[model samples]
Target: MKKLILVRHAKSSWEHQVTDHERPLNERGFQDANLVSNNLNLDGLKPDLILCSDSVRTITTASIFTSNLNIDESKVIFKPELYDFTGGNLVNAIKNCDDTVGSIMLFGHNHAITSFVNTYGHIYIDNVPTCGVVVIGFLINKWKDLNKGKTIKTVFPRDLRSSIHSR
Candidate 1:
């Protein structure tokens, strides 16, 4: 069996006049990630490995959760391919994942993360908001042979009552 945890990069800052990949998470993004991490820890959601996007925002988002979990640094991999916003790109990263690992948490851009869960998971998610956590389980032993299995759960930042209402 395999478990895939998909997390969309947290809300990033546009205040910085930098490239998209260089953008960092905003203040709320950090708070959201911390809140979601605390919840995930309470839920006992731990992964054998984590595949993270090498971009600034994605990496920072992943770090927050991993730090809370105290996941070994060796278990986290920053892949350049995950920096994309295409489902195919995310799937490619999954396909290349080490078969020995039973569960993996992937942090990346949305549309891709949202589309991936919608495409492979049994449930329908209209959108995977920033810092959203979507868990899906596959019955297959090998990650490469993974297909539609089941939708385990989705933990949205707002669902945790951490939504930031606009003024």
Candidate 2:
């Protein structure tokens, strides 16, 4: 079985005048990233490989997962195509995954990410908010044979934040 996890980059800063690719993560982005990363770690779901967009926000978000999940730097791959706004490019990336890897994670943008999850995942999600995560599992042994799979899990920062009981 092959497992694929999709993560939408955390909220980015519009305060800067830089291009979209250079825009960095805002304070909320950092907190959200940390929250999601911690949640994934607590769930004990580790990725064999993580594919991330080279954009600043996405990279920063993926880095948080790397740190919190203890994923080695070598396992993280920065793909320029993931910067794409459509899911087709993202699907191509998944199709190219090495079969040796059992589980993979992708940190990217939407509506592509949202489309991919809803298009292929057995579940329909209205939206994948910033720093949201969706896990889909395919029964195939090879990445090339990837087809619509089961939506195993979904995690969102607001859900976690709301679940907290303050002192």
Candidate 3:
């Protein structure tokens, strides 16, 4: 079984006049990233590889999850191609991954993330919000063989907020 975890980068700040690629995460982004990552139940499944977009917002979001999960920084690969919002490059990047990897965690932008999940996963999601996580499981062994798979779990900051605050 192969597991793929898709995480949308945290909410980005528009206050800066920097280019889109250089936009940093907003304050809410940091909080949401921490909340969602801390709430995930990995069930002993850890990512063998982490593919992250080279953009600043994506990197910051991925870094928070990595820190919370105790994932080694060495496992991460910042790919410029993953910055795509179209999902085409995202699909290609995933399909081209080494066959040796059983699980992969990808940090990217949407509608690519949302579109990919709805297309590949069994469940249909309206949107994958910032700092949202969707875990998908495929029956195939090789990355190239990835097909329609199960939507195992979804962790969104909005959902967590209510539950956390209630408790």
Candidate 4:
């Protein structure tokens, strides 16, 4: 079985005059990233590979999860192709992933992230909010044979934040 975990980048700052690719995460983004990552229960679903968009916001969000989850930094591969907003490039990237990898965690932008999850995962999430994580499990042995899979779990910042407030 192959497991695929999708993560959307945290809220980016619009205060900068830089291009979209260079925009960093804002204060709320940092908090949400840390909160969600720290609260995640991986349940032994350690990723063999981490595919991340090279954009600043995505990279920073990935960094927070890797650090919080204690995942090795070496496992992360920055892919400029993953910066794509459309799901096409994102689909190609996942399909092209090495078969040797049993599991993959991807960090990317919206539309692509949300679209992929909706198409591939069983759950119909209207939106995968910033710093949100959706874990899907595929029954196929090869990445190339990927098809509609079960949505194993989801860790959204809002869900975690709501629990915290209720406590």
Q: What overall lDDT goes with each candidate model?
A: 0.88, 0.92, 0.96, 0.95
User: Candidate 1 overall Cα lDDT vs. reference?
Assistant: 0.88
| Candidate 1 C-alpha error for residue 81, in Å | 0.7
Location of the lowest summed lDDT over 10 successive residues in candidate 1: 158-167
lDDT order, best first, reads: 3, 4, 2, 1
Model 2: per-residue lDDT, tens digit, 1-167? 99999999999999999999999999999999998888774256578899999999999999998898888989999999999888899999999999999999999999999999998899999999999999999999999998999999999998988888442
Runs of candidate 1 with Cα error greater than 4 angstroms are 41-45, 162-167
Deviating ranges (above 4 Å) for candidate 2: 41-43, 165-167
Error of 1 at 159 (Å): 0.7
Model 4: per-residue lDDT, tens digit, 73-166? 9999999999999899999999999999999999999999999999999999999999999999999988989899999999999999999999
Alpha-carbon runs more than 4 Å astray in model 4: none
Look at candidate 1 and give me any clashing residue pairs. Answer: none
User: How many pairs of residues collide in model 3?
Assistant: 0
Worst 10 residues of 3 by lDDT: 36-45
lDDT of 3 by residue, 55-154 (tens): 9999999999999999999999999999999999999999999999999999999999999999999999999999999999999989998799999999
